[model samples]
Target: MTSPQPTPAPGRVGSAIGWSYVVTAGRIGSSVIVTFLLAKLLGPSEFGLLAMATVFILFAQTLIQQGLVAAIVQRDKLTAEHLDAAFVVLVLAGLGVGLLTAAVSPLWALINRAPDLTEVCLALSPLVLVQGLSIVPEAILRRELQFRSIAIRTLLASVLSGVVGLALALGGAGIWALVGQQLVNAVAGLVVLWLVCPWRPSRRPKLGAIRELWAFSAHAANAGLGSLISSKADILFTGIFFGPVATGIYRLAARLPDMLVDVTVRSIQQVSLSSLSRLQQDRARFAAHLVQLQHLGAVAGLPVLGVLAATARPLVEFLGPQWAGTEIPLQLLCVFGAVNVFGVLLGPALQAIGQPGKLAAILWSRGLLGVATLAAVGALITSDDPVGQATAVAVAGIAIQLTVNAASIWVTVHRVARASIGRFLAPTGPAVLAALAASLVPFATDRLGVDELGPLARLLVVGAAAGLVAAAVLWSTDRPLRQLVTPRLMRLRRTRAATGTPAGAHSVEASATRSTEK
Candidate 1:
């Protein structure tokens, strides 16, 4: 991957972020709708079986597209030859994974002792090939920073696929409903991506371009493996020992907090890596970007996760009373997800700066530690207590995630940016206090004999108070929070003067200049 010669313009950066939020918002809205419907329609056992099948599919997905997609996004120059080569790689990998998935489904089913997994895996095999066909087109758009088209396509696919999934579940298709959703999402997403970014490849595969991508791909392959472990190893462990019911409950436990953190982090991530790659040669600009992203992301992220953790009871119940069994696990996952989000940008930052090997190491360390901890904890759970096992996993997960993320952030900030960890995490201090302050509302409200209040009411009280406390703390403690809108306002003034042409549309450069001048 070559370096982006020029830093992305501020207008472009702002536009990218704005469109990314839309993409997230659209997907989230549809996902919430789909999840709620699925939770209501499917029982725990059925969902658990589906979850187990998904681990295999996701593993296949990681191999088929993730490494190549990341390489494409990071590559500074894109040739038809390069894209053609990527498409060829994806096709071969997808075909191999699909056949391998079909071959191993029965063995996985035997291990999990879920006969349904064998069939579900077979049904999902075609998706591997279908999605492989989609990656290059999607990467082409992403590398060009064409997020609006991506957002519209995603939103449309999500809504359409969600409708199909909901209908299937309601019609008593059970586990197949979830399977149907995956299939629909893939087909719909691919179609829309192709429609919007319709550039057909004319060149045959170029070995030279493929070799260049391998420069990024080799380390990226490790990072992808680590990601697979970090994301799915728990589900794998749960399915192996506890059965579909437990795995389903674990899925429910993890769903919301993961959604919240993922949505919040992705809003920045869609632009951060690609945009930041260009400015890496300018250390001052790069450091300033890292500082602002970490601080702002924490200020927003901490309170959301904190509130969710503290109020997991109502949130779990909000899904349905049948899901009450997952309350504690949900709480644990909320906290775990909250702590882990701090390091989300670190791996991306390293990869963007041409240190994919370093990122692979960090991700591998975390993934391995997580898997080991899950195994050790699994060995200790001899009782038939699924919730208890989940609780143990959650606790270990939080501790491990926090430790790894904190250490990784420290190393990345100090080594790469020459910035202190204190500066990196400074925003968290007040954010924590705000979260603590927010927790008090629920405590006080419960004391007021409103324990019978609906989950929504309790959530509103706690969430609103948390939002206020977070704002107050950031406003009081973080200077950047005070002028959050100043840049946009300045840009608006400049835009008016220029009659709507962008004025120095590189936000990081502008922000860095301001910091240095001060």
Candidate 2:
């Protein structure tokens, strides 16, 4: 028998961030390749069928976690009683959800009017139990900052799932390819978690012990439900308003462009919440650090949006003729995605400050705004046209989310950092210029014969050149970029004297007090 590798002890937050990046990047990269392969092997209609099925699977998976994962991570001290109680509650919830989903599979399909959803739900229901069993253990790993093991296990599952999905699709499995891959991936990951994590829950759950966690868990779960709405509502609206093929196209467009932003934001948020929770007692450090990460997230993420928006044409072609009609939503969502990138830090930052309730409210409000906007826009804008309707859904959903997130961040900063919105956003100003410069290059090059080149070749060359130019522009214009990008030897010339900064503070409760005014 193979000896189980002992999980690494929690390391520095930066190291955890690094490993999380690997895990996230690996998953997304494999996803991209898998998507490409699947798109080639299957038609848009087939993809649409899978998309409909996925709505339930993702919804159930999200419901299973119920954000108790956050409760575990944010709690100051965890005991065996806490673990045992959480495990019991989570497992029971998982089993119940899985069984309920399986029982209702046909009804769900009939309700959605998608006959294929029944088998999809039944196939995917078991994953809920596996996912539920894994959540507490995974949450514990995250709390311990054990991302190395997490990354390894995730990479293993992702790669293996990708291979299986590809082989099955190539073998003409159609939608079953997707269903099988998801189930295999979940089971593989759960098995790995069990092998690596040494913690074993006691036999019984103490209801009283869980009461202390309920306060936080309740808010977390509510926020998660809201997030569930926000994240999946667009798909629901699309499937309802436009049908499966259009939904599939919209899903495709949303996936590739948003992948980078999603990965970067999730990784940064993971690090942000973990680090900020540690610094919660020292308000100044927490404020300053969050400000830094907010800036970092924007600068790192915004350029990709700009690039995607500029290059949508080539990408649409690269996906082949089957994806021809997806360009509009692809383009519109990229723009909204750019707008949304600025507020990535707001939600997690608020949660870090013990305001999950407020965040939950904002998320739900965001969801309502999204659903309302999507439904309203779908009915009103380009109502006669399917693609136009889909584009409107993408735009409305993301725009409401962006608006709500910005307002939430503004409020959080005022309530917690006692700073003006402009001050909090000040570091982000240069990023806009850098992204604009990067974007203009490709657009300009397209006019200068870049478009005549073969599609893939043109994409690579223009993309690489644009990135280099953007780096150069930022390096010349921004001191932070210069310092951050410079080699260790070259960094000697950059002085930290100018970079040294003071801090500010405000409290979440008892009104904003000015103790350490800037």
Candidate 3:
């Protein structure tokens, strides 16, 4: 048997992270625009209906993707036969999920006590199919580290989706406007992926060739179930106990933190999975990379989560008066956000080290804890007060989830990555302390006199002040962050000198690295 040759360690991690930031910024900007317009056009009830529809669509989409894309990305070798079989399986699964969603829409509406939810779910069913088709092509781009292309495609889709949704809502389409927006985004994304990705299905499927792939994907499916539960448990609980209006508030409140976490941590995971997969056989190199990633997670995540936690009230109030109830839930969720960043990074590390089952184990434990916490909280809160119930449930679940996720990542880092406890805790502990100190600026300001400021002005002041303080603190105390951010800045200077396009330098470097490796 021939040993797997070591894959090249492309210098694209930084570039990938940059592209992710740019893409995330564009999406966030577009989201803010769409959200403001939607809130003006639609009332809380309509927004709630749209939020509920999205939860169902997201749940189905998660199941259909099932981490198979990551599995494919981590593989040492890729072939046309493998991509074909994966696509075939995904399409079949998408069809099944779509059918199941349609079949169960009425049941869901009945259970949730929302008669209109059935129509909303039925309207959103095609999204599952669209997402399933898009997954493989997007995975192919990610596997090849074509983040620039991915970023461009995502920006276009976000723009189109937002524009269409806003137009429809202004034209009095109500919740259907939201549904149409999602379908448009999905279809547009699939079209872009098909156009940008060069891969095409072969003439025939090779079932035997994909069996090992399925073995990997089966474990991924287990992990993905846990991931889905972790991601959606709060929304599900809110919808069940607090109703659609409360869910809408929770959804919007959680949006900023979720976007930041996903953009920062998941972007790293994308590059890490491909990069670390290349270093799988070198235990020393793999361990070193894991350490660097742990620090990276803390340096990037802690301050962001802290700032959000500190300024959540102002942020929520500024968004709208209806959003004020979201403050506590958003703050409590920041702890989970910080812990989840580490857990997410570790899962990719396990997969890169050829331990997909370990990732599955960790996620399963997390999901179980999350569900139990939610159930217990629900049992305790029988009140008709939606915001109160939602707050209690969110606080309890996030606390349990933070504990469970932290323990899981620690174990994975120690057992799978073979790192010591001290090493594991060192970077994160200090970063958290530094973040807390930096976060106090906003908290103290809110306590002192800033409370009198109007919500909009207060939110802007707190957000800007918190950002500047956090950056200064991070640059002063966090050497790793300085190192990481500094090199990229220098590279921009060099690229500007050479090509006179500082903006395009990172993407150019990324493309060059991928080409050299190929």
lDDT by candidate, in order shown: 0.77, 0.74, 0.75
How many clashing pairs per prediction, in order? 6, 0, 0
Tens digits of per-residue lDDT, candidate 3, 157-231, equal 999999999989989898888888888887887888788888887778885667867778888878887777776
Give me the overall lDDT of model 2. Answer: 0.74
How do the residues 145-191 of candidate 1 rate in per-residue lDDT, one tens digit apiece?
78889998999989999999999988989888898998898889888
- By lDDT, highest first, what's the ranking? 1, 3, 2
- lDDT score of residue 493 within candidate 1: 84
Candidate 3 C-alpha error for residue 335, in Å: 2.8
By TM-score: ranked, best first: 1, 3, 2
Better of 1 and 2 by TM-score: 1
- Candidate 2: list runs displaced more than 4 Å: 1-11, 381-385, 487-518
